[model samples]
Target chain A: NTSELASHELASHELASHDRTTFNPTTEHLTFAARVAWRNAARCVGRGYWPALAVRDLRHISEPQQVFRELQRHLRQAWNGGRIRSTISVFGPGVRILNDQLIRYAGYPDGLGDPQNRRLTAELTALGWSPPVQRSDFDVLPVAIETGGRTQLFEWQADDVQEVAIVHPEVGDLGLRWHALPVISNMELRFAGLTYACAPFNGWYMETEIGARNLADQGRYDRLPELAQRLGLDTARERSLWRDRALVELNRAVLHSFDAAGVRLDDHHSLTRQFVAFEERERAAGRRVNGQWDWLIPPLSPATTPVWARSYREDRELTPGFFHSRRSAF
Target chain B: NTSELASHELASHELASHDRTTFNPTTEHLTFAARVAWRNAARCVGRGYWPALAVRDLRHISEPQQVFRELQRHLRQAWNGGRIRSTISVFGPGVRILNDQLIRYAGYPDGLGDPQNRRLTAELTALGWSPPVQRSDFDVLPVAIETGGRTQLFEWQADDVQEVAIVHPEVGDLGLRWHALPVISNMELRFAGLTYACAPFNGWYMETEIGARNLADQGRYDRLPELAQRLGLDTARERSLWRDRALVELNRAVLHSFDAAGVRLDDHHSLTRQFVAFEERERAAGRRVNGQWDWLIPPLSPATTPVWARSYREDRELTPGFFHSRRSAF
Candidate 1:
């Protein structure tokens, strides 16, 4: 128990660069550390199920092609016929995945698709990755993996990716959709003083992440104005609250569509409640739950959620955790 | 210019408690300090009009009875026939207002009114302040002031307090209403090594303050459930977004009613834009605007505002500002 406590205390601090050479954790230790890392992810509201995370240790495979193949396997396995599984694929040092996420739609030059991915889309285009002859907003980008001073692009076979078409129960179709899996590939997984530069990890999507932010944010999809127009709401006056109505409907669509599609997507309300449960479980286990309150509270009707009323200690030093990478593979 | 720079620099730090005894400021200095304190208030989104703030130097008054009378005068002058004015009355040390605000609705024994004022209402009742013969949700509370180890209650004359009946343009009447003037009475104004224990400040209402929070917050009036029911929204399903729709309608009602009543009320959109202008003006004058982001963004559709995209330094160390008092008067 004392040794476990000491290990946890050590993991709570960022290991200096010199510690990396001396640290050599066993495969079991690596797996447990990875799970603890997921547990330590402060910004994730879906961390209630962190203990059930499947950490695929691909640290032995150093070749880019092998890494790409494993990543493809990861996508298919995690998809699990729409019943999405929480997963992470940890690769060895010097292996980097350029894509911010395993699957992201291309953002075209003319302000089409996800504007957040415009720079990355342009970069992929420069790397000899050809776009489809007919450009669409939903063109999935190729995963660019870098290894041994060389980089290669790998495309996910169409069958590997699953996307849900957003449809409101009351408002009907508005032709909006988002990918099922959200495997974040850019962040480094640091545990036991060792860093995995290519550790792509994911849980199922929270509806608000897609609805209120990704689609509704002005800088992202910028969908509210169009949604408002479609709903025949008055956009002339801010007091009319056309944007607020559109946002709620959009979120409703995301939740309803995901449910109808039988995909494992979490609604903000249910997810926030689970987060509260997660906090209680952590407290019972004698562990402090550090969280960034801004990230914890959903963007939609935030005050309705319990997280809005509570303050959180935003301690980012917790390890066996994911961190921003020092450099991009691109 | 050098002396002015020195004075500005000196005003930026919290003067130690020891300095309070030695501090002696002229009326002109006190007036300027009050305005600057408003400008430096981190949580006030309406502070774009800080320069126009009328500071009444009632600092000479020490009696509780006279303080109560002056506060009533402050309320009426601030009302200005529904075209509210930003005003602050600075009373000298040992003068403390027990009420959190100059005007707030009382919460009865049965949870009919504002629950936030329940404890205060009970305390006032214990001090011999009588409730109305017929209890209502919008009963204006009597002001309690403490001076020289004695507490006294003062009631505002009927015409002095201007209240707007909240009625939606489309949703029509739900029988909700709020007072026009928001005179915060409890906070201590710290400036020039001095603390004004009873400085009550007034600003016009921002519709969201009444609609999205005071009425809609679960701990307050909790109007969303009733409003949602009135609007015939599906309450059983979270995906129906009943609370969100009700919130927007409630906010719309507040804005529409205030406009119809010819009361000065700032909508979130316009106020946030003004806040941006305030930030620009402060920056141009070589001053960093410190703000609490949570307080700055409106609770309703927060991401829709310009303030949502931005981050603010939440420095509480800034002086010539309002601070939470060490102890409550009650």
Candidate 2:
């Protein structure tokens, strides 16, 4: 989390030339957010601020002058050619306005908590885009785009919120596709029941996928003695099975994240008809004629996504700081 | 520094804190100034932007449009709402703009850097109200504010610039002082020589000062051990002066730092004068009784500060898909 991210790490650091500039997620990013959260907690504790009353009387100040005076000090510093470490709210009593006002003052629209602020994040952690339809520690059901065969998957993890994208060698138009609901704090995640798993071909595989890592990157194929035993029977078949296994594992991960998000893609009538037509075409036209799709596009989650709420206002509030801290393991 | 001040470590830090809060100066307050300086650096590096060259490229797109069109997007999740972290820029060939619109857009500032910014930095830094200003390595000055004989003194130093002040502690009235022309840059620091010197108690004395700790919830006191011993012993009268040589050195250090910060007294009037009347008043005033000060204040530096410019920039311009790695230190 940074200026817009509400990330504490981004706020209170002195990145000198002699100092290192690398991100340690939990230590740096999370710790900073924790600091800000603590600051917020201090304000809450000092003024008896809590979940129920946080929205109303957000201000613990007596009159508007108390807040405005603080704002004036920060503004004066900024105008006096002073540098503001506002990212971490270090200006102290100086920052006493709504997030929108801060952004408006700084030449941007509402950031962080706004439903439409995408510029404040790195990946698709925003609930509106590839929002997580459902999730369990092990499985997730998500509505993602089917650009060819590859897709990006979003997840809400303890350490970071991020999207895991699987880019097939020949698929360049791939991206995650999703259907978003307004907001939901508590929702059940659906599993794909995917026990299917895949393993990638190792260097010793006698036969490997054409688009797979070549000998240049994998080194000589002869180096893996253990895997060479596959040649005795059918090395090509073994390699194929391994690759499929790898895909299966990746698919399961995607599902796990989707299930965690708890918002699934809705039924698209035209898409349903197109799916049938596309299946017929694939069968009649043959999977690969002239550099067409090399693999089958998995069926989109059943048009019947699990029943879930479209929005919830009082239950969960999505903030850039917390979301950025415990982001997905992309 | 253990983030704690020893009862006899140093007292200049407190003076610096006072200066920082009041924006008046005399002696350089090391610890307080250092904290302010570092914070200033953060402000400089992380300063919020002003609406410079403004360009409304065609129409702004929302996260939904981005998902539908496969365009780049930025957004926050339903967690941490205030984090800011997205940057999406498009270049020439990739963008389509109308000729007339392009002309209009040209009026907006294209970049963040502005000449006014640098000049203002130069001024704040000189006043010891900003970062640890240095040029090359030689111009780095250690700032500290000292107090003695009930008078406050501000000290600005380096291999180049030198300035000192003596003033009443309460009303902040200025008195006897000496100054040197200011020159900035690391190269100038090698020549740091200007010093604060005076007569009477100026030779040596122990002093204690207290301020906030790292936790920001506690207070700490630091004492100048060396200053205490020097004033305690009349070494010239003692036959064992040689055996106490170590004490001499420590006392000398204490005296040096102590003298540089001048004095802190409640009255603006002098205790020493040329005639018997002055001597009588001095004896009458003696040393007004006092106790320890336990509160929070920031330090200040003189109006002359050194300059620092980085040697590397282009090497670390994070590009698309390229953000600096956050290290554990961050």
Candidate 3:
């Protein structure tokens, strides 16, 4: 039924030009060694591995259009311009799917990642899922890290400075508008903010996310607050209390989080540290002793001066030593 | 090199007795009613399904201690504890895992569901796999849902209250203490003041993380000043605002969760509808106009105040005709 290039063609590809005997079937255990694999198939066959197995060309099986669309979607997501990655791994195996990238994902029959909803354990067991297993797999999710991937550069020169809005959390809604910061860099990785750049691009383009990370790690942000010491970074002042104000502002954002889980922008990794530090600083600033602790608790504060349920911006700050001890009583 | 009786005995246990001798060596396929199986001995070889798959049976694998300890730890994780159910189908073409519990999940090789992660695509092709190329040869994933697997219930006999501390988002180091309200019904699930439940008795449990969801679905929350109606909930008249006050006082603890995704208290069913409503109330309140905009868009009264960001207090009662479209912009 099919054209044969001669039985020797098959032997030539595998063995030398030796004698050509058709075949015999055999069963043998096989070893596995691959960076990635799909084990779901093994379960159905009722077997594990079969070494010296046959291989087929899977590329032929795919419908071309489907593959193209998928790649497009992945690209849009990887770069936050089009599809913004929102889901954080809070339920089910705690997958950190930033940019929707998968490092290690095995076939999970049902979605167990819902923080609010979960699968019944009994049902899953009947489905052949043996959880509480100690096998973990991972794959490096791709990011615009200059250290690992190559960068593309963009040359879009603007005619004038553009202003963007910064909506403050407490001021109600009016966001302060400021000129876009400049992105001035000669890095090849930045192709008009695609490589490792997010929205606020002025003109400075670095190599990658790792590149930005390296700068921050190398004291870039540390040096930044000092540059604005007079502008707003001055922590020593009380009236314009720059330090407290900045700390307070940062705290406000966190205060604005959903639940105590602190659901804020995942991209803002350094946010937690600042929030924690400000809190520590506040506690360090004791409440001059005779602060109103009784009235500030629940119903007392509700009627007098309203306290937002989601915030820690209370009327007073207790010394850490005092707070640690007195909190239970309060 | 092999023992006759031992091999036959093992094979016999797997197959029917009379069928063993009657099993033709030349037979290429086997049938059980409508269930036709690929008759190749290939299953007898390879990694061996037992080696590649982890079943809780404990007998099929080794180091029972390792398995037990791991399960003990993983069960506490939100993902493992939360999983409701999953089903895996290992087709000849590929492995399919269908998880349909709280959220939906179906994973095959990346190429199956996701186009980008084609690790399975390559591996499958190499394994000479295809989608039913021939009906005679077969495949399938070996997974099924089981009974008596797991169900969590948080049964409380009385309103035995407890306490939990939360770090205020803005307040920093000085922490806030919220009383844990343990009313089994609407009190904790609908209103607030629910830290982790103390279970039926005083039993120790493990943990995991979750998010805010039930708050909205249950309709317990509303926009800011609107949510303030909580103040009106008190039968204790001295303070008409006691309800709102109580919510804030126990805000952290009130919103404390009993997520099914993590290690659950064996005694709690963790009602979904009510559980999600409280979180939603806060979210709904947050969605309302930002508090500062009250000046631009004044609330029902100059004194209504913006409780939208904090607790949902109902103080705004704007007349339907009170649109201020003609007002000058501030």
Candidate 4:
């Protein structure tokens, strides 16, 4: 009885009947929605460049192998070797893709018992992803793709990824490198009341996101003590402000390296200015600019920014933007 | 009928009869209590050096003129030509001393006609206390003392005060100065249930108390914007984080100048470490260490300190510590 009507005809009839409550977007509508979502990203300091966002619509592709291939291409194109481009790849809706990001640095267990992402590393190993020949801090993680109710792994090509060399002369080949594209993959795209579960977006890195939190935070890389020692700061006492001095130097190196390598990275200072301008522009355009104070303010030297002095309203509207997906029990 | 008994005998009888409820202290008891009160000051990071505190018992001297003289002496001795010492002069109980601190900078009306403490400065001027020969950012206000219910003015001698030269090369001779002694005169001292309303206490400078709040707070000196400009930070946009950069430099100058002048000033980092050590010692001695986390943490680089990582209980115990006096309407 169901085979009497075509799938497209049935979908169109359902959409027409529930037009007020739900939406089924075409490829063109998805592309436009992605651009608007970038503009609506409240916490982003780089919204002024929303017009330059390159959104790839791949809504028809549902195979895990094909999705993996497209993701690899997206990363390579976005990396662009020291000239990172802001891009996003839209996958078919309702596909459950596992892993926070298509690309992440693998954190292995060092046997000596340092804090590492043992669970994640183990999971990747079980899924047949090989670790780098030499275990290093900056090893790239394999992509995990789930489609047709099945999970598959894909290896990232090393050459396609771009990394800037940290500028500290004393660091001595510890190989401090950050992958150029910061693609947030796990977030769901909601547009016109329809959810695209597998859309991933990328933006150029903000230096403090790497220097202040990723490396400086005690939980992640925790490089402050080592950097302080290398910089000849007195680590014996906190009164010397060794950690603060080290943090400033680390942030400086991140900015310098990115700039020297011609990578499109924004320093917190520059980003703050850009955000202020964006706010003004949005206001002039008769749009209410929403932001989260904590997210808008960079972690390093926060009070130095104008955002710290002002409060922002949290906008919870869920259209033409990305939303965090609920975690699966698995 | 009341004149039949001697005052000391009557006070002793009342104390002996009501031992569990209310109690009074002799001059000897007051001196010891003052030392203990300082040790119990929750907000103070320099309590480890409480043994070195100089307590001047002036409770017997209730005359306004005598109190003023003692205050002058306290300031001079505490300044000690940049080798600052912690000192306190106890005034008689229930005496009304009007100012929060013995020393505060005068705020003047600019061309913008903004609300300044012009009334206070004018009142002091009328009382024959001269303003600085040249009006400057850190001009010290004349001391106001009230004893026997009569208010009197006492001019602070410029020679006794020491000022640190700011490190920024471009900020030439802005005449930035802070009175060497931070004598908190208006707070009440409670020991063994008796209240001394006019007890004033001083501590060695914590640089953040000067650089971070006194100089940087918007309502007070509000010097960050000017300092940022002088430091050659781009203030054309909010994102430049000029304020943060300027604040760091300002703190640096304070520490450097204090060190150069042989002043007993402690930077927040050193103070935090010292506080942590103090807490450990108190714990080992079975004394509960009470503190307010907000007050204990330095305004600048707060999270960099270990104090920021932990919580402290607000001790509600009234006795054996200093307490904030209720503000008088007049």
Writing each residue's lDDT as its tens digit, candidate 4 over B1-330 gives 133124334444654566645455666566666767887888887888776778888878777778777887887888877778888888775466766677766666661111134566666677677766777666667777766666788776766455666544335443466655777877788865677788777887898777776667665566788888777877885334456667766766666666766777888877788889989888886778878664677766555666766677878673578888666321
TM-score (all chains, Cα) for each model: 0.93, 0.15, 0.18, 0.68
Question: How good is the docking of model 2, by CAPRI class?
Answer: incorrect
lDDT, candidate 3, B1-59, per-residue tens: 14423543443344443354344321111111001111011111111111112112211
User: How much is the lDDT of residue A187 in candidate 2?
Assistant: 18
Q: Kindly list the per-residue Cα lDDT of model 1 for residues A1-330, writing each as its tens digit.
A: 466556555544434323677766656566668878888888888888976788898888879889988998999899998899998988877888889999999999898788899988888888879989898878899988888777788888988789989887877887889999999989988865578888999889988889998999999998999999989998998767788889988988898898899999887777898899999989987889979887888888788787888888866878878998768743
Give lDDT tens digits, candidate 2, residues A1-330: 134344423444422222333422323433343333322221111111111111111123323344334333433332222111121112111121211112210111222122222332223234234323442111222212112233333222322212223222222212322112111111111111101010000010101111111110122111112222222222343212222222222233233333344422211222233434433453463431111111111111111111010111121221211121121121
Model 1 TM-score (2 dp): 0.93
Model 4 — TM-score against the truth? 0.68
Off by over 4 Å in 1: A1-27, B1-24
Which consecutive 10 residues in model 2 chain A have the weakest lDDT in total?
A195-204
Model 3 off-target regions past 4 Å? A1-180, A188-330, B1-55, B58-99, B102-209, B212-255, B258-330
Alpha-carbon RMSD, each predicted model: 3.8, 34.9, 32.3, 9.2
Lowest lDDT block of 10, candidate 4 chain A: A1-10
DockQ of each: 0.63, 0.00, 0.01, 0.16
Ten residues in sequence with the least summed lDDT for candidate 3 chain A: A27-36
Candidate 2 stretches greater than 4 Å from native: A1-330, B2-27, B30-34, B40-330
Candidate 1: lDDT of B321?
A: 87
Candidate 4 lDDT score at position A158: 71
